[model samples]
Target: MGNDGSGAGDGTKATEDAESTQVYRTFRRARDLLLTHREDYAAAREEFAWPEFAEFNWALDWFDRIAAEERNAGRPALWIVEEDGADNRWTFSELSARSNQVANWLRGLGVRRGDRLILMLGNQVELWETILACMKLGAVIIPASTLLAPADLRDRVERGAARHVVVRDADTATFADVAGDYTRIAVGERVPGWESFADARTAEATFSPDGVTRADDELLLYFTSGTTAKPKLVRHTHISYPVGHLSTMYWIGLEPGDVHLNISSPGWAKHAWSNVFAPWNAEATVFLYNYGRFDAAGLMEQMDRCGITSFCAPPTVWRMLIQADLTALRNPPRKVVGAGEPLNPEVIDQVERAWGVTIRDGFGQTETSVQIANTPGQPVKPGSMGRAVPGFTVALVDPVTGQPASEGEICLDLRSRPVGLMTGYAGDDERTEAAFADGYYHTGDVGTIDDDGYITYVGRTDDVFKASDYRISPFELESVLLEHDAVAEAAVVPAPDEIRLSVPKAYVVLADGYQPDAATAESILAFARKNLAPYKRIRRIEFADLPKTISGKIRRVELRGRENTKGDSRATTEFREEDFPSLRG
Candidate 1:
């Protein structure tokens, strides 16, 4: 009878511990499977499952657990290599201790669970430390770029409902006109009215959570880089980014002790994707090459010197790199990938010829981790973004018919919601509902899947237009334009035509030493005529710089508005393909 009573009394505590163990094991099991089958996509996708956990804190359960291990103690977790040779590296043990101290200090400053904090620092140690600290405290973080002006800062502070703000000392003056009741903490040199982040060093290095962190607790709130309209606030849970980046780790082909360098700015989701969660999750080193201006040769030199194994960059960087001498780098990374925009086939071919490795393409957004990618050991089809990664069910839903189609808007099936997906757009139920309507989470982007399950990117839904009743993907024309030697960058927009209703017009940014004159226009137009079909031929050409959003995406909305206004008269800088005699068929 006594044994039965004792069993009943201890049942709750024993069951709680067992549940915690189950959650940890489940998360680790999924992660290890991806790592084991890093090269075998068929087997991984067939047998992968996202682990569910009721109570989970990634920092405590995963990172701290790994930190305690003897193998990872002295290993470099974060390595920041600067251009001037003043590099910084933090071991797993040091970071784990530092974040504990920061968490304790932050809690003392009235940062409680569920409070939202604004982290607006540069690519410094404090940025990483604060992220870990916030996760430990279970405080939601709103990562803002340092490039934002006073107006944007006010919007984030107000709309984000931020209770605390951490920023660099140099940016403190910009906040003078800003009005907020949040606690202000400054990194770098001490500021007059701001609390010194350096003071956290004196706090104890052992932190105790006030309460258990639920897996669904809000962890991060990201303001999307505005390309079309005002940015949407993307909300992610503790599990969404922390535990959900196993796919990202697999997509990049990361392995333990590998030096992984990803070119991205802080405050962006990709920064956290590679710089923090993905690399750390794989027990790899997060390598950063900081520079004021991009020097492709300089970057390659650094990569060679540091022995960087895995690398990722945006299409913009890849385009600039192909412009330089591709053979400048002696050793290239085996695992190279591109994201942010679709990489042109021309750029991929150039890199493959120069280096032995092929640049794989990955597709995803701030709303989720990588949904589609050309993972390692796969047959990469040119222009295709490869198949859907494990844990995501991608469907191409026809916009008009609202049925599954071979080519349509890319969306994720909500019935089997992926763990990497965001909770919703914070404080915008209307927008959130619209995105998740029709039993799918619409991506606002368009794509087409082939018979082999490879997905090729079409342009954005708003950017795709029709010419002579035939749909035109601007990306297709832009890819062809990029193939030209004189064409540095190009954006194709629809021009109002009398007979065809609309025709394709390209805004060209000439390469160095290439003149933007009649001769250049004739050569470019003649080349386009030979390459493109008659229906997709270039009608108008403008030699002008393209307008880009702050996040570096071309603002086609602005270009479309400009084209609609200019009817017949060509601008002083504009050149029409009709002006070229050889272009006239």
Candidate 2:
């Protein structure tokens, strides 16, 4: 697929070029439609349609074309802020030229079309450049985190069939024991027998694709976070992510020239969602604040100084931010959002009270972009994750009857597949088929849609349990527990019981200045009793750190296992309500 123009005078060349033009027009029309109705969610949902593309490369067709425009030529596309107070901003034209050079340099190093490359870098300029260069060359990317150990690297290298690797100099040693014939390229300081990424500067600035990029060509491969089980490889086509993040742009209320900051790790899907695709799709600047440790006050000061307009973070960060001084920053971002996990009403209420802006919550997965989100100018119900975004049809199905129900499994209709949905789990036909069963893509999550179409998230299908024949959503109990003063984080799971089959038990993480003594346990238990239903009451409390997956999600499966192995016994750390006299009538 080298840009040799071998078919310069052939009829096939003419047809391919014309088809590419048509694809670009269709994509632009769809993008412009969303921008036109940015605030009108109802109208946007009713009129929006996913654009069809036969052959397209987003970097070549959309981003490059826009970079040449006078309006966006000198506009900043990427802005990186360092913890040491150093910052750098790259304009649209600069990045376009830089990525072209990188693409040319990589091609010289035997990086061919369809070759899988593992990119493990932090928030830096080269990371963004490589993403665009890979897209231009039609090479598939497997983004791994720098935090992965050698064992994890082996899994990615073997399972992903990686042909090339781009990593920092410090992390090069992690792959020393990883057996592979792949090309090693180091980004920082020169390494022995490894290609230096800095050499790209000497390469030619002009770039040409070997051939047209098909819309359905594999582009990104993501490994799931393994919160419940082993990580699954998810494959996305070119159009799935590059063009599908319009929903995310609309969700964040992004506009041209706006600086958008999203707190997420490099390897995760959320990073791609906001850091690259969504911001660029809206012609906005992607802003990053690199820090070793999270400091809420320092982050707010940067946001205030940099004039950030839109912000998105996980619920964990939002929870941490509220614990600090919410009034630190004189100017809060106009658009604030939380995801990765459901945001509790208590956290949302605190932020709204302090900043005068509601924290919108959105629901999605690694397999797709923002499927359901609280869009701009919409009334955010306290805990609802809003209605389905444009181009998605959400349904709730009963687990037992296999029929549509008001409260059951949250799923997506496959009759009209959303462009953001992944192609499939690569090499896992059984899992993919099961996911697409019943003419829907099962999300493995449960939710209830109100009369007005606002969907409130129930716990995961596996996490939701029954106590005394009453359905209990752990999220509901956790949210109530978060409202208490002493509780910082809570994970509720079912404990074995003879009469009720199972009983509600909570593993709590105490807040600052709070103790794990009897006084504190009684107060938290008393608060739960008042706020929760009788059936959902916490029968026992354990003041300890909750176990979580590497991606920061609570691992209730492990906690459930701990309960199952108890065998009619209690741990020494556990404090039962029966042991407290304050709960006795």
Candidate 3:
């Protein structure tokens, strides 16, 4: 047997097959160990090791094997419920066969090994099918968001060197101006110049790889959210995401047959993190509730009706969820986690009171998987994002000294490089070298570590500033502001001051039923003064929507720029602390 699905191969191929089997067994052993010690974080960290392999194809080896097993083949692998009351489900066996057909069809259309393909689609069945098919076919995938306009599409097509694009039929027009020779394939209704994704149904249901896939082969290219600057291309190998997500599975506490719901949009790294790799790695069902607009009550209904056992959501969604009637759902998920940003303590406290499950926070980036997290059964300290996950060695390095410290930049020690980390920034060797320089992958984010090894996020290196010569963490002040009822969301940036070099200014988004008036500003400012230190208090507030990346991360860089250019002038919406005499203590 060979990796190419040929039986009774020559001596070299037979030897290759034996190596492949050993790799599979080693990977399975690691996965099973984590599952066994799911709640025992200490045992898991001390025992777990990343499986090493020379040649490995996760889709061909792991997923296909699980699909053929009698115990797992019939289990539901994907469950999607739409807002219009449409429901669809697919078993492991079905997706395996469907992906095979898609692979064969794609190969016929010149999608060969090493070809770069842009996958832009919603939470549809075709997305999963195509992803599996691409893996089997040994094609590199560049996942793009549908919200991208023509200019953004052009950047991906040109910079990514994409050889093909599979997107929604309606979006085909956006590509008209994106000049490229890439093959166009559209889902949904037919387009004149584009191949219909529906045609895959008529292709052969059995497929075979043309050659063996090395574990180090390029697999996924993700564009960073670009909160501060232009998006950088992050590259991952075949083993990095597929095998490395074992840490993610353990962090989420996923188990076999568990139905997990992760609230995220397609075309982002987090979507693949939870929606595809993490859940499937644990042999759990990936459940999704697709909606045009986020309705907290409606989403809760689906979670109850579908029996979602594990849930993962961003901090933004978690904040909105708390505003709704949380008790409407009869059953809440047993396992819950928050990512994308450091969740506020107030939000976590509210969720725990309503549902009895603490919202554990995990920290990572587009460059890596969950590096630090509050794992299952761990004592989650308020405002801390837990400890280093298994298989990762995390350190806080002082920026000036470049040495390990108690409070500094959060970094990953590359002495034992984790499997979930990306290879480097694609097409930019200089940036890649800078990131991996000094024997550590600098995360560009700052944090503090306690005596117990728990790491709490402070803020991005560029986002942290000084106020009256005292270090100011915007996240800390924003957390206090979020504790107020008048604040739906808040962002803090440094504003120029004459007496003190700079002062903390807050941009607040009022919650429902709250007016963005002088009274509301005073209430929020007074609350911050009561909770935070005087130096960290929000001295000025402006009621306005936060500027964010399309991925929903607040772009504090933009707010900082706005404040710098404003000089001494004040906007109509701005309110200063001096305007209220009562708040002066």
Candidate 4:
């Protein structure tokens, strides 16, 4: 859609303008309701409703409006801290004007509405600018991690049908082998054939949309992390994330002027969830700390210095943070939450003991926003991922009988679809149909609901196995293993056994000052036996690094494969319960 250079006087334009205002107001009302009931989960659930919209552009109708507001205009919208102590901050009005210039610049380069653009950038100001600019231009964004290899880049370009690419200048050589007709744009030092992103600053500061963006118009296409199999393309509409993250904002307890720091890399959905949508939805500043390597102490220093009030991090980061000095920070964030994977109870306990704040757990997938979470001021049941957030109807469905159950596959009832849910798996009708079957959207994860409605996460449906006909959740055994001071991380999988079909086997990573010897394995196994039931005890243990996806999720699928192929011979590093006869009864 091209701007015909027409002035804003036509009847069609007038009607569209009125519709846009109506949708913006509707969105604001829903957001304000959640903010008002921040601590009152029951009231938020009772009063909240997803705003309906026929035509809406979040950047044009919502972000721009907020940017111009007197209260928010001068407030910092984004703050980035470098590892070397360098920092940059952008205000709401500054970003609004900057994104407009970028939008105008991109339009001049032939970028059009509905065109798919591959955005592979690190945590930098240009990343945020391109995001808003693309939204204003109605371009679909395909976010990619900088860690992706050239083959992965080719897959994204081909499968995503990308028309444009924006990446760091150092990564320009990566595209040399990835063949595409897409336009190339670089953010750092100018490349020979690539367009300079710095040129966007010289374009017009004022922006005009070529056409109206419908609420359901495609905005983002995310590729899953491929922890189990090939990555699936997940599609989201203009409203799904921009307006949908109110639940995430509520889950993180974000408020106006709050500085929220979420430890996540760009090119992933979690980045968009916390670093982009959730914090901004509440008019809070999105804070980022860029570092080449993870240093827990350094991160904490920045958090304290930045006056961060709300903090969200993946389970991996939380686990590492516990290994460092927890009391180093003079002031810990008041609001702490964990996602990506379930936080082990031990890690939560350590943080709570040090900071006097519990690490709330939230459950969701790439297909939707926060479905279940421990809201602020709620009694967080240990190991439970709280109740369903407002606007979502969560149920545990029996995979076989297709009926609601107290324990089964965690799913969302499609009868009343939540605005936060994705549209579908793009270009894969078979997968989409299967996911939306049985009147629900299957999360492919298992969980159990207690009488009080808190949901405890079981392992993935594929990861859960049986031993002696008794069901076993790998997460449960892993959690027990993590409780030991010698065990840093552990992944449990079934190994072939002569009797009982199979038995639980653990692949563990040792903590500092712990050796990877039989003595260490024996200590961990003994600790597990004392803590876990007999049926779920660790029958065998091996010291090794856990394989993980780029997003930092454990790949149990690979470990299961390794066990299936291990025909009876065990590695020298593996220790079996039978080898240690002293413990046998």
Worst 10 residues of 1 by lDDT: 1-10
The lDDT for every candidate, in the order shown, is: 0.89, 0.90, 0.92, 0.92
lDDT of 3 at 552: 91
For model 1, state the Cα shift of residue 116 in Å. Answer: 0.9
Candidate 3 lDDT (Cα, whole model)?
0.92
Which regions of candidate 1 fall more than 4 Å away from where they truly are? Answer: 1-21
Q: How far is candidate 4 from the true structure (C-alpha RMSD, Å)?
A: 1.7
Off by over 4 Å in 4: 1-6, 10-17
Per-residue lDDT for 156 in model 2?
A: 88
Ranking 1 against 3 by TM-score, winner: 3
Ranking by lDDT: 3, 4, 2, 1
Positional deviation of residue 380's Cα in model 2 after best superposition, in angstroms:
1.1
Return the top candidate by lDDT. Answer: 3
What is the C-alpha lDDT profile of model 3 across 1-585, one tens digit per residue?
Answer: 235664445776778667767776888899999999998999999999999888888887888878888998679999999899999999999999999999999999999999999999999999999999999999999999999999888888888999999999988998988998998999999999999999999999998788889889999999888774678999999999999899999999999999999998899999999999999999999999999999999999999999999999999999999999998878999999999999999999999999999999999888899999999999999999999999999999999999999999999999989998999999999999999999999999999999999999999999999998899999999999999987889999999999998999999999999988899888888888889987898899999999988889999999999999999898888999999999876
Residue 564 alpha-carbon offset, candidate 1, angstroms: 1.8
What would the TM-scores of all predictions be?
0.96, 0.97, 0.98, 0.98
> Taking the candidates one at a time, how many backbone clashes does each contain?
0, 1, 0, 0
